[model samples]
Target: MKRLNILVTGGAGYLGSMISTKLIEIGHNVTVIDILEFNKTSLSHLFVKKGFKFIKADVRNKKLLKNLVKKKDIIIPLAALVGAPLCDKHPKKTKEINFDTIRYILSIIKPSQKMIYPNTNSGYGIGKKNNFCDEKSPLNPISLYGKTKVDAEKIILKHKNSVVFRLATVFGYSFRMRTDLLVNFLVNKAVVDGEIKLFEPHFRRNYIHVLDVANAFIFAIKNFSRMKGNIYNVGLSTANLTKLELAKLIKKYVSGTKIRIIKNRKDPDKRDYFVSNKKIEKLGFRPSVSIEDGIKELNYIYSNFNFKKNKNNY
Candidate 1:
């Protein structure tokens, strides 16, 4: 693999931190720009690495972003308000960061510079029976977060040297462990409290590990000419599962843990559906980590984690 200058925005977050780590490991010059919305503790692992540079900034800062984006090989835009509930709580900020930041970055970048934009399968909204969403599937986003992703995808697609990946719900441990994502949340509850809660237990969705998400970025970067101006759904085909089925997997990991179902507390997020990774698969991309392995890793971390002592760690 060639060592390229890789610029990752939101590189301090769950997936961003992991992706930055991977790039550095591969001998690339890695630059991470983040507002540290969750704080900078999660990114401490990168501080000591020689090839990695950290910028405590936001993408909306055009002066800073323009200067930083100069001569970069690939720019991955992953900073966002995240899920439906979070986006609903702060609609304006969500739109600004998720939609506006992307447009701003694209405006400043050179046409020769390649980019791998990360979108979400949640943009698929819903699905029909026996039907799975592929790259060509219609986008009908139901949440502010999903809508913002759609907006980003449109802007990136117009660029001749960009690839759009509509990602599935990411699981597994990153340098920063996030409990907000479904698989990690359930695994945490089951291991710590011996119980997990489910709402709309039968609603279906796809999943991928954080490590694989990072690999997809690398694969697209290396194969940029072939992948340019195309959209790929990046995830395992057989990894789609409902809330109930995922609970069972967690239970299998933490023996004797019970699952409790809660009804009517809130309606499900409209971003429910299965996705196909065929496009990226054709480009020789495959997920190496299984959900079972991810569950085991999360179980170990959560079991020994002390909230009081570690609250200030990350």
Candidate 2:
């Protein structure tokens, strides 16, 4: 494969940190732009690489973004306010970064340049019972976070030169680890607190490892001709599980963890759906890490490491 010039926004973030490093390792010239909201040292190790370049700036800066867009062969937009709770806290900021920044990029980039975007499968809010959601499924986003991502996806599809991955709830460890994610949170609670409280435990959802998601970007870059103009649901097909089932799995790793199921209580974030990964799988993309492996990794991290000063939650 020939070396290509690629730009990644939010490169110091959890998923971005992994993606930036992988792109550099494969001999691509990568330029990363991030404001470093969480941890400043996430990309500290990549500073010495010849192909890696880091710029500390917000994606909403139109002048800086337009200049960067002109020189890249491929663009991966990973910058956004990720979860529902975080988006709720900053509604105005969410609209500007998640939706508006994307619109601005679409207007400036040439039709020849390729863009790979990551969207959440939570857009399939409250799916019909016993039914699986595919890429063709109707998107009914519940939260501000989901709505902005779904809206952004609609505009990206119209461009016909972009690839969108409707990703499942991502898990596992990265250079910038996130413990607030469902699987990671449960595992950490089990290890540290030895107990958990569940509301609406039977609501089902899908999952995928963070590394698998990073690899999907590389796969799309290599096969852009075949993947562009289409949206694929990226996830592990074996891991469609409910909150209760997930807690039980964590207990297997962390022995004697107590689980308290709270009935008649409501979960504020009511995203519940099972996703079908058949589309991406047919295209020859498979996720390597299993939920069991991810839980074990999180268990080790929480039990041994000192995250006293680390901001693991957003």
Alpha-carbon deviation at 63 in model 2, angstroms: 0.6
Per-residue C-alpha lDDT of model 1 across residues 89-125, encoded as one tens digit per residue: 8889899999998898888888998888888777574
lDDT of each: 0.83, 0.90
Among these predictions, the greatest TM-score belongs to 2
Supply candidate 2's per-residue lDDT for 19: 93
- Segments in model 1 whose C-alpha atoms lie over 4 Å from true places: 125-131, 265-267, 307-314
Q: What TM-scores do the predictions have? A: 0.93, 0.97
| Clash pairs, model 2 backbone | none
Cα error, residue 225 of model 2, in Å, equals 0.9
